[model samples]
Target: MTADHTPGRVTGADGPAPVPAHGPVRAVGVLVPARDERDHVEACLDAALTALARLPPEIVTALCLVVDRSGDGTGAVARRAVAAHGHTRTTVDVIANAAPLRIGEVRNLGARTLLRRLHPVAPERTWLLSTDADSTVGPDWAVRHLHLADAGVDAVAGGIELDGPGRLGADPDPSGCARPPVPDLYAANLGVRAAPFGEVGGFPAVVSGEEHALLDLLRRAGHRLVTGADIVVRTSARTQGRAAGGLADLLRERAAERPVTAVEVPAADGG
Candidate 1:
């Protein structure tokens, strides 16, 4: 939300808009939703760009950063990243001040916009990958998803290793002991075909259950989803201050949806 002094689309009565970073991105459309993430945005973008760079230019579409009405520098940082790649075929741009479009709403908008803009020929085949701005995906992240898709699965879930403020403390709470096996679709490393996602009506609007809800819908619709540790990404352990309760909340939430358990969270590396 920092005064968008660049050059592009003006909101309501705003005179002129910053000329948005030029984009008609053609690769995998990576959509990231961020709020107050100034501290971690750089490394996060680094990982995303690195992964995007590894893809064939024709295969890698555009990386879209959705700024969620944050007063912080998240959007500004995203703009700069896109600017550096703007002069080329791959482009990145900020879809500014989309506040009312909280978490899932903004995410849906970002993915759908890129799907329409970049893949005008066949949006259904276009791949849209979603991740939190604070998460860092591995070098082969995009490739793995593409490979997974090529293998006939409609969706592929990736792995997440906790880091930063999310790491567990030493002398861990005994309740935090059991480590549950990773599931098939962690939001941090999620990827899907654009058509199925659109068909499912995007993610649930509810903040906490949106990702889970989407998975439920996909499963119910008979779309196959496979979770793999090879598709690794690291995530923040903090869940809006619910980290102390550990996986307890996750278990409680999932239990209502299906059978659940208290899987322990291993201490994050470098902890």
Candidate 2:
């Protein structure tokens, strides 16, 4: 929403304000796509900022909140957080998603915009993490990412553990994770290599299947997708409420079609 003019960095003719270029930056850009998410936006930003605090300010250069046009004050909340956080070195960008596109479209738009200003190799050494505005990162989320990167893994598919007593939609399922016909691989906790994410073109503008689609591309390219105890993020069932028809029935409706086109993405190399 603001033009970047931070010292040591050139402001884009039309991009969010740039972070103060105290030194060179590298790492994944956390891209959050939201729509009218004021309900949990503040907590989300706080958690994200907290996670970043674990590392040096120079590493996590920015937080890109892609806010779709909403009558609800989601955008306003994002702006407030940016101001409150003292965006000294951490650049906060508010992108509008007023266009009538689907989930994949939003991520693609954001990833492309952010990638232009980000360090290409950082994602491999860094993570381009994505989460909805209704989600929050774990206490050690960022730290874990750095750890995984140090271990030389390219893609980390971490899952979110819902906050206890989440919205009506997040009831615990005794049925178990495997019982669900279509398991969700949400980007909320997905940490992927930046170069691979870009090489695969990030997310596509589709009604669904964004994460799986991107994963498919990455796997085919022979990147390693590792699961880790680290890199966890807490997500609200409210954002994925559509599956169950309302906030109250979300978890129960886990069985559904894959959001991304499900093709055989070859197994990633363990290397």
- Judging by TM-score against the true structure, name the best candidate: 2
Superposed on all Cα atoms, the candidates' RMSDs to the truth, in angstroms, are 14.0, 11.9
Cα deviation at 108, candidate 1, in Å, is 0.6
| Cand. 1 TM to true fold | 0.71
Q: What are the lDDT figures for the candidates, one per model?
A: 0.61, 0.60
The ten-residue window of minimal lDDT in model 2 covers 1-10
Candidate 2, residues 1-271, lDDT tens digits: the string is 1111111111112333223232222565678888878888888888887777777655755578888667788899888987787646555678887878777787777776666656444544446777778788876776676555444455666556665433211223566543422233566777666766777777765566677777777767776555423345666643455222322244433323222222121122121
Q: Indicate the residue-level lDDT of 59 in model 1.
A: 71
**Per-residue lDDT of model 1, residues 156-226, tens digit only:** 56556666333221333369865553333456678877767888998877655456678778778876555
Estimate TM-scores for all models: 0.71, 0.72
- lDDT (C-alpha) at residue 210 in model 1: 57
